[model samples]
Target: MVQPLSDERAPLEGVIEISTGALRGETRDGVARYLGVPYSAAPFGDRRFRLPAPVEPWEGVRDATAFGPTAPQSPYAGALGELLPTVAIPGDEILHVNIWAPSDAAGAPYPVMVWMHGGSLKHGSNALPGYDGATFARDGVVFVSVNYRLGAEGFSVLGGAPLNLGLHDQLAALRWVQAEIAAFGGDPRRVTVFGQSAGGATVAALAASPVAGEVMRQALVMSGPLEAKDPADAGRITALIARELGVEATRDAFAAVDPDRLVAAQAKVLAGSSPLGGGPAYAVAIDDDLVPVSPGDGLSAGASSNVPLVIGTTTEEYRLWLVPSGAVDRITRLHLAIGRRAAKISAAAVRRYRANRPGAKHGEVFGAILTDVLLRRSEYRAADARAAAGAPTWVYEFAWRSPVRELGAAHAVELGFVFDGLAGADSVALAGASAPQSLAAEMHGAWVAFATTGDPGWPKWSTERTVRVFGGAGGGATVVPAPRLDELQELGG
Candidate 1:
């Protein structure tokens, strides 16, 4: 009943105080934004590859008018690059955070949402215009987007260094939010953390962590994998990168290599890897303290069961990987067989998908099957487990098919809508010129509602498995009793 960027008030707002000192940001369209605020110490010199350290206290109000550097990483390669826009800022102290809040600042203490972006744990930053928090701030929420170490410096498991440094960095940022968000008129107790893809997967891992209750009140995992690898399995990617750099797979040896060079090697080693057959890609690893097990397994086992959660996937997540690269066309019957075997998909699942999508090519069928195995099914199992424990969980699907590139509700297409950043160039690159504002409003409103009230205007997931389908055929939103219940059930997730 009651509510609520730069594109639409004034500029150069005022100062807000925190533990570090003071920050001066701008107010545009009634939203005050503090950009490029450091939440951790610089990870260069002797600190490289170590756990995130506390930020040194400042002497005066630091200028937070511009975004800080992004984590060291490479841009998307090939056709994927053309479709996904990336921002690459330089420097070693990339552990930063961006914030947006209502200019009036305080009332009931606005609901807070912290964003972790998805880029295979190697790409993306809070600086991207598409990740801007202005819209969220305008809607009565204090929003944050965090930049953590990535690639070798963050995720690479090495001798003499902590594993999952990336996740640890995020944990540090959350701790900072809990301590300092009230300065920006944000309620520390009402924090809701959400992310897409790799970011989403990280959110799941965090939800399963013992410290989850100390930081965030809720979590939303969007189009993310649910698996965690053992140290040996997860470190395989690091070993390959070390081999490429001609060094021992240890913290000291990698500390000598330039971040850009390591990023280049990361791209080279990961090249030609498909979504299904991508051998040893970066993923969250099980550790004794942070994430003790895979999120899917841990979550289904009732870890973090008290955390209200929302989990969903785009209708065609794999199509984002397969369609633009022309890989979809090259898929054949043999490829399907190998994929089915590797994914453990049953013959019944294959036949079920084919029947559901009549006249579908082999690539289409394969993409559908791969999406379920790699994404949808695991999330469903997590939700089902939480539901059985009497925990509140909600499910939804981004079904709006993008006209550009025939991406049918593909991965990341929902992001522009979710953030209400459809006009942003990065979003338009995938969603195209003529996207729908009403649809964006619908999805964005739901996320806001979820953050504000823990109810996204939809039924809670239960034995019924109700899912709200957002912005597909006939437009607007619809609540359905499991849109593809038969196919999903047949898939045996």
Candidate 2:
């Protein structure tokens, strides 16, 4: 039998009662335990492939002790499971949200931060050890992490189904926060949406969305921005994959297959076909109603929110993707493809990239090229758009090198440090044996400050002002030359 939950957890909007559940936590100061509270009901059955329908109200307090099952994902079937624990639900209708906040009774609202996890829109889980919100809660912010549709379940395009259903799921979560966060000691008016990679790109899309603007107040994007695959391209990709499964492109055919079988088929199709790599399958699609247009197009057209923004990318970002493992060859091939796709790189810039690293091998250039093609140029462009849109923006580059062998400030490295929880399981790679307490303090404090106030204790990025070079000499910050920025700007242009 489910035990009765404490009433200390209040209902958001003064209408929905939020029940309490237990949480496991440990921060720099010490260890502390808390609870996971549900703001909405589990999405299931008829709601699959549609917007997150409102969860039916429950009469008695419900137990939110454990995290809800993760949205479904392709099972790579390996030690990856031990590394990343995903709570898999069988249905395509998977929308669940989890919140971790200080349990102590509060009379006032606290600042809110909603996190969107990243998996190239294919795989990610809110239950990852790295994403635990206890540290953020202990740090005095009401933290919420979300689970949206993933892989084909969320991204697949069908005429009747909601395009960009994943995005809609995010919007639903934000709406919940706006209506109910106050009951959990969170200030809805001061909410900030942030994410990494796909998550970051989602935030950028939200910034461009009129509906998301009404719900969100600010944003922090790490390594992403708005831009879904073209609809025709997405449809063609879906068709090709559907054909592989002996299923038609119609919704009825898709609905007939088990979610696991569908995911397995998707993984098979992705392995054999280089869709996004150019054969035609695309992960994100232009859902005009949800996304309207590509994020790049939206920014250029001045269709973005004017909220404060904080955007940053790590220094050795490429190195993360080109580890010494089996990734070297794949990295090289992807880089060659990037060189082919690059439409704006001047011959001079290409020469410069090569000349700067005269002793480097084709492998290194390939990795760097991929970084420039996918992350660097996109990031620079997003900053440019934010400045153009008249939003208060701050752009920083995390240049801190890692003590680890080759994962220098790798993907998701800054996460735990920024949350002030560099002691978590996934964070072990970042903190090292002798973790940089001071640097973590500086970084964490800046994020907390940003969540508290509109500013991050730094000058804002403007069209006139370009980039902030974090971890410069004298342990301070510096600005990049405008001409250099202009040169990078040409890539995105």
Best by TM-score: 1
Stretches off by above 4 angstroms in model 1 are 1-13, 106-108
User: Which ranges in model 2 have alpha carbons more than 4 Å from their true place?
Assistant: 1-16, 19-41, 75-94, 105-107, 272-282, 329-338, 341-344, 403-405, 464-466, 471-493
TM-score each candidate. Answer: 0.96, 0.85
**What C-alpha lDDT, on a 0 to 100 scale, does residue 129 get in candidate 1?**
88
TM-score of 2: 0.85
- Per-residue lDDT tens digits for candidate 2, residues 116-145, read 998767778777777887767777788888
Pairs that clash in candidate 1: 9-28, 9-29
lDDT against true structure, model 2: 0.65
Residue 171 in model 2: lDDT: 88
Candidate 1, position 341, lDDT? 81
- Tell me how candidate 1 scores on lDDT: 0.88
